[model samples]
Target: MNQSFPKAEKLKSKKHIERLFAEGKSISKFPLRLVYLKTGLPEETRIQAAVSASKRNFKKAVDRNRIKRLLREAYRLNKYRITEETDASYAFMILYLGREIPEYEKIDHKMKQLLALFLEKETGKKI
Candidate 1:
């Protein structure tokens, strides 16, 4: 309802992100790969995510950072849907696997679609 992305909702931790990738279940739908695992926190529902552009595809750190920003923004906007629907806490990492950087609008659309798919996969029901 606020329509603003807040800092409290963000997922930021190098160790946690790594653990999510290490121990989580993964789902891929081209250009987007989602890895998630349940968390032990009682009241706090936290998400840890990252968007990766392979060095083989993008040689510049600036390009990689830009794409990661776009992906993070898209995820930030749609994450409320995930928070609203699920009671179980989770930690997630989303990887970008495309050969080229996509436009922000396209990335945003894909982010929504992927979030829905992930919710459905985890809950066995449409969101």
Candidate 2:
């Protein structure tokens, strides 16, 4: 209900991150790919997310950080699409796969698509 990306919403635990990569289901939407797994965390912390921009593609840290900022902003704004009342919690790692920097509009559109796709898969209910 806060609608803010606080520390609780960030996917930061080492064990969770490792488990997500090892056992998560993945989906790609152009520049963004999401790896997500259901977690044992409580409903209040239902969804925890991490964003990554590949170091190999973005040689400069600034560039990578900028891309990650965009990704996080987009997800922050649109997370409600996938945040329904449910018993399951999810951990998500969003990987940026673009060769070039992307604009906010493009990232926003794709983020919506990604969330919608995730919801569809999760509930077999279309939004």
Model 1: per-residue Cα lDDT over 16-59, one tens digit each: 77788789898877788888888764475455455566778889
Give every collision pair in model 2: none
| TM-score for candidate 1 | 0.85
Give candidate 2 regions above 4 Å deviation: 85-87
Per-residue lDDT over 1-127 for candidate 2, one digit per residue giving the tens place of the 0 to 100 score: 4568999999999999999999999998998999999988876788999999999999999999999999999999998777763457899999999999999999999998988888888888787
Residue 97's lDDT in candidate 1 = 89
**Every candidate's lDDT:** 0.77, 0.90
Clash count list over all predictions? 0, 0
lDDT top scorer: 2
Over 4 Å off, model 1: 2-10
Reference-based TM-score of each model:
0.85, 0.95
